[model samples]
Target chain A: MRLPNKTCAMGATIARINDGDTVMVGGFGVPGTPMTLIHALVAHGAKNLTIIKNDANEPGMGIDHLLRAGLVKRLITTHLGLNAHAIGLMNAGKIEVEFNAQGILAERIRAGGAGIGAILSDVGIDTELAQGKQIVEVEGKPHLVETALRADVALIHADRADPFGNLGYVATARNFNPVMAMAAKCVIVEAEAVVPLGALPADAVQTPGVFVDHVVALETLTEEYAVVER
Target chain B: MIARAALEIESGMTVNLGIGLPTKVIDHLPSHLEVCLHTENGMSGIGPTLPSDRADRNLIDAGGAYVSTVPGSAFFDSVTSFAMVRSGRLDLTMLGAFEVGANGDLANWKIPGKFSPGVGGGIELAQKARRVVVLTTHTDRAGKPKLKTECSLPLTARGCVARIFTDMAVIDVGPEGFELVETAQGVSSADVAAATGAPLRIPNTALPSF
Candidate 1:
């Protein structure tokens, strides 16, 4: 459904993001991560969230705040090496982390958006990652049948968005946001700048407004989260 | 080591340089070489590491190092980036490994209890690239050999690596075994064989020094 007026007040939209939801957050590190929206979720105190993303955003930053608050029941991501707290929690049996090979994970989300059931891959075949998954044989070659991944809601970060919600991503910030936007039931965007309806060039729009549910203009970017710490 | 591996790359190749030692390959490349660097973080035409002053927080490589993009650089989403990889569009992939078996089994992702970044895009790149090469030290910090009869650590992909460029030697993984391609200046053939955890196949002709 179209968002009322194509813009959402943070409080009004966040309230609809209920507890025990599956959230697909877009980012590799801090670039395309919707930090303001993430903090809003933390402030909302939604519990038992299943967060799917590329990284955990290190300790005390982005997603780490949600994890520190014990809000995440499970994390599905490709990398957690940067977040020691997440590693500690997983090792202690306090949280569950499902690791997917980065490419495979993105493809699964794409498959979900395309309404495909599964895609065959040889990525993790015969490895620890293939332990419990089905091994199907295609033309005598064993390929792991990775299922599609869909989320309850997608919280995406965009460099620019029009009032109609067409998103323009910045650099590597475009990584997972476009795909997640297509695979989620509800897609809310945190745009650094929201311009007039026709401001973003049609060809430059990475994610069309059709996939977006709401657009929330960010107040400002916190530089503290921008630096890459080793 | 990276300097030697850079020689293997040809012009017009689409290459994916993995993290660690392989990432250094970019610096040793010829000034006029025209290969396009693809970072699995969804960008092609990767440029050299940007200076901190010129670095944009939003423009970083897959390894989180600030990087610039070439004039023809095209940014895409993760799905398209990986589709290029999984479809074998990459001409070469140079990766770092904890151990690579005689049969080309790569185990670079995890080490028992140590934390790993998960098998990010290593498996796909290794499995689907036209040629898979590894850039690593001959041994671990404690001087234990990383080339193995079989990978004791978790395997990233099966029978994928074609060649290895290490500090001690350049070896090609052949059906017979790890054949010694060339030996480094300070490393003796005997010493290279002894340091290898797996059996080494010596070439009949005199080995060249790199």
Candidate 2:
């Protein structure tokens, strides 16, 4: 069968994902995770990957599948307090973890997406999160310089997408997808529904088509709750 | 403590309630006033918790609890959400504490031998919010005082907390040190002073009720 525009088979897209690549996965809890794409990546067996996300989801869900698959080498996130497996991995020295204050993490990604080098802040100056960071003085006040974070690929889920790749997300599920879409070298979206162009109104489009590289429409969109691995 | 903390919140203000004790403050907010709630997970105008049968699984507060939305609720991405926090748009922030030092230093994220995965948005919310209030008990589970001259646990942010509401008293972090604002009913200034790990100062004026 001939290929259709930007839409590609999951296998072909997952094949392009390489080891040691930094990936930004979108979701807050189980809501907006790109589960089908993640499953495909697991099936493809790519290892030594680094994932930057909001949290290491609860055991047997979301990023935990990748962690269980022994694919993720490093995790840069705000918290993993609820996920025992991620904590166990960190405690066992099986994985490297870098914790950013949640807001700083989001801002750094945004800075990377906007091409800015770094931003200064007083958020973690006295905490472990700022231990070795460069402290710059501005006008007399000291601030920690937080570097921008960009990824090699961003695997995001969208509620709806157009053929041209414009996207829309639902509710709180919209958390990290739009920013991750901007900060990655390749943006692959798992769209529940791929609508015709212009069907997603310009005013409603959260991530413009220009930032998207590929769209893989799910064969059968899994219910949001079913994405919970447990 | 939660009720006392809720009283500090004014009408029509945007507030960020940290995990643990601070989250309970929402239950005590006056019904006549409209208060907007901001969660780091990316939404504002939060309503009360929802029953499981009525909950939309996809919609939840940052704490992972199902929550309803107010009339003006708006959703955005992580970037915009954090921007609102970092830019000082939040009127108040109430957080739980492990230990709060005399100079207003906060240490809430971790303690030795415990698996605290990471510090979430507490850092930014502590530093940027117009006011930072803390909710905690007078002592640890072991009955050891938690309000200290210097934090014994790992610090989350420095000199960020402005006021604290404990089960025993309402205290303010002033330039001189911890000032006893008021005590719980039937609790005395001396009782609060003894409970605090750090020195407690009582102003000359009559202390007001929380």
The TM-score leader among the candidates is: 1
- The two-chain DockQ for each candidate, comma-separated, is 0.72, 0.67
What's the DockQ of model 1?
0.72
- Tell me the tens digit of each residue's lDDT in model 2 across B56-92: 7678888888888888899888888888998899999
What is the per-residue lDDT of model 1 for residues A1-230, given as tens digits with 9 covering 90 to 100?
Answer: 63335787887887778889999999997778889999999998889999999889888888998999999999999888778888898888888989998989998999988899989988878688998898899999998999999999999999999988899998899999999999999899999999987788899888989889999998888864476655
Return the top candidate by lDDT. 1
Docking class of 1: medium
Clashing pairs in 2: none
Q: Provide the clash count, candidate 1.
A: 0
Deviating ranges (above 4 Å) for candidate 1: A1-4
i-RMS values of the candidates, in order?
A: 1.5, 2.2
TM-score of each: 0.96, 0.94
In model 2 chain B, the worst 10-residue window by lDDT is: B50-59
